[model samples]
Target: MSLEQSSIRDAAIKAPGRRSPAANAPSLESLVSTARALVPRLRERGQQTEIERRVSEETNQLFHRAGFFRLMQPARYGGYEYGFTALLDVISEIGRGCTSSAWACSLGTIHQWLLGLFPAQAQDDVWGKNPRAIMCGSYSPITAAEAVDGGYLIRGKWRFASNVDNSPWAVLGVQLPEENGAGFLLAPRCDWSIEDDWHVAGQAGTGSKTVVIDKPTFVPGHRKLTFAEAASGAPPGAAVNPNPLYSIPFLSAIPVCLVAPLLGTAQGAIDAFVELCENRVTRGGIGGAGARLGQFAHVQSRLADAAAAVDAARLVLDRDITDVELTAAQGRRVSVETRIRNRRGHAYAAKLSHSAVQALFSCVGGSSLALDQPVQRMWRDANAIAQHITLNWDAVSTMVGQHMLGLEPKGAY
Candidate 1:
């Protein structure tokens, strides 16, 4: 047998029990409220977060104190069993003030939810010792795993691992060749090494790097989760977590969380643009820039439209999250149509946010184009977020149309 297979065998042999500590936890609603209240402070630190190429240590500590990471963690540990809506609200609020900070926090916090979907033993190894410890992840199946006695030996490199600088653990996507077909696996952070390769134009502080796993690392049977299991709506954590929220389809919830931060970023842009408009003076013109800015029908129209777009997007997000939460509470599977529609809503929001930023920037005139201007930063961040595959207009719009017309959806919906 190969070294990969050997590692798999070792992992299977060392299956460990799931771990949990009965500690007091904060409520998810309260966490959202606190996050909203912190937006002004986060906005003040936005430049600092960008300069550090990661969220400021102070901001991170603040979020941790607010229990932002425990929104989706299993209640058996010190976590509130809230669904996707609360997370959406928190991310949106943060993004509204500082896009990059919001993105980092959102990425760092949501990994806890994903971790809860792993096998109990895998969850134990991560949260058993420190429930507050966070995990960062990337779900690209760039690596391969070979099955052996108790588990599989995994080897591959996953790119775009966000917030890895702050995380002690990671979960990655791997593919294993099987007799019947191929199996997609979710494995723990211990099996891989992180590569510092994050370089990007906007949201530079996200620290989205490459996670490298050379040769093979052992992942025990209990620690492995397959795409088939996820598709069946029977994740390994089901027996232990016993929460319907954990049972929701992975595709539906994952993308929603991934893109929600952009909504917050768009809000931040609007706020900044409005503030600039209020103080800016038109140079070498008959009327002052502020007076013209306020008086122009075009400016008023654009602001109204942008505000409406952001609000509409928020409504869609709220509605979709409510569906997920209600369905989970009722102990029923969320329909594919609902998931597809939710994806559509998310994509639409992203598109609208980009447009809103563009509209606001256009009204700000040439002076706002300076790199130092907050409006310019918001514009750049909004465009960057729009480029994400999950927010791809073509894919999401097409998927929703296909589902609506009684056609099968493609990709991870």
Candidate 2:
């Protein structure tokens, strides 16, 4: 028998039977409200969170108890089976508290959806024993691997694994030998180690560090998925989990996760700016004594503009989220055109969010620049998220333009 078949047989014997979510799965409204409630506490912990260079254990536990990680998890395993739009609502609200915390939550939550796209056996292997398990991933395929009898021997370092400190497993991208492309492997905690190299000026609490597989580790075949298979919009998981959400093209909506936190980050900046303007008084300037900052026409205009930009950003994101969900619901594949448009929307929304925060940051005085000030932290974290390659305006716009201009796009979809 093939090693892969043998591995499958072993897993089948150990894997538990499927089950459905509890009768009282969280409603979308309840999840959003729960996220909103986390804000005040998350706000209280924001500065110390960054200083600690990772989300505190208490915050993670709160998310666990609130069912945030199960937002996009499979219903068969007690996940709410909520879609991306639900993710948008909950994660953006969380961002209003702390960008780093929101980011950690975003990655943790979205990866559940991504994992649901994997084959059934793989999903069972990860979640069957621990329904609450959440994983971190590094999707770049720069690591090394060799095809073996059962699966492959993988060994290398993958970087930018967000929320790694809090996750017990990793989805590491690997380039299969002699293949034209790369794929992903599901590795447990025993297969890899974390490198504490996450020091940064922004989004520090995400703890996005490197994961090193110090030795050639044997990964079972059922736990592997190639990028080609994922992009095909007919991922193996679609058969086991008949939800259309799983059938949506990988790149079409997955990038949405990268920008979702920024939506809340910008809104959070807007909130802080409003609060700052309401009570801040101009002091000791030549002609500006005892003036309420909010009274100035120019300051008012900045606030209005920031609000409009952030509002527009949410509309754009929601539009695409709706489009993809509806398309998937109707049992149609997300077309290439829609995919490119969604890509543009993701990058554009990110641009709007970054610009909004930048405007508010410029208007806020030096006092806001202090390490603990919410607006400053929001600005820093927004800038950091905008730097993500998927959200880089120039790169995504150029790729979209190329597709529109009738040339094959050169970038990752």
The candidate scoring highest on lDDT is 2
- The sequence of per-residue lDDT tens digits that candidate 1 reaches over residues 1-413 is 45754554443222111111224645445666788888888777766666676776677778788877777688877776666776776788878778887887888777777777777877888889988888777776666678888888877788887777777777777776673333344445566677876666788777777777787777776766676666556788788888777788777667767677888877888888788767766673565533646567888888888898787676666666666656766777888777777788778878987888888888878888776677787888888888888888988888777777888877567
lDDT of 2 by residue, 1-413 (tens): 45754554444222211112446576677878899988989998999999989987789989999998988888888887777777787889999999999888889998898898899999999999998999999999998678889888988899999989899889989887756689899999888999999999889989999999888889998898888888888899988888788888888888878888899999988888888988799883577779888887888888888888887787777777777777877778889999999999999999999999998888777788788789999988999999999899999999999999999998877
Whole-structure CA lDDT of model 1: 0.73
Clashing pairs in 1: 12-150, 95-264, 95-265, 96-264, 96-268, 282-289
Clashes of each: 6, 0
Q: Can you list the residue pairs that collide in candidate 2?
A: none
Question: Residue 113 of model 2: what lDDT?
Answer: 87
Number of backbone clashes in candidate 2: 0
- Candidate 2 achieves a global lDDT of 0.85
lDDT (0-100) at residue 394 of candidate 2?
A: 96
Q: Which regions of candidate 2 are displaced past 4 Å? A: 1-23
List ranges where model 1 is wrong by over 4 Å.
1-29, 179-191, 284-292
How displaced is residue 340 in candidate 1, in Å? 1.5
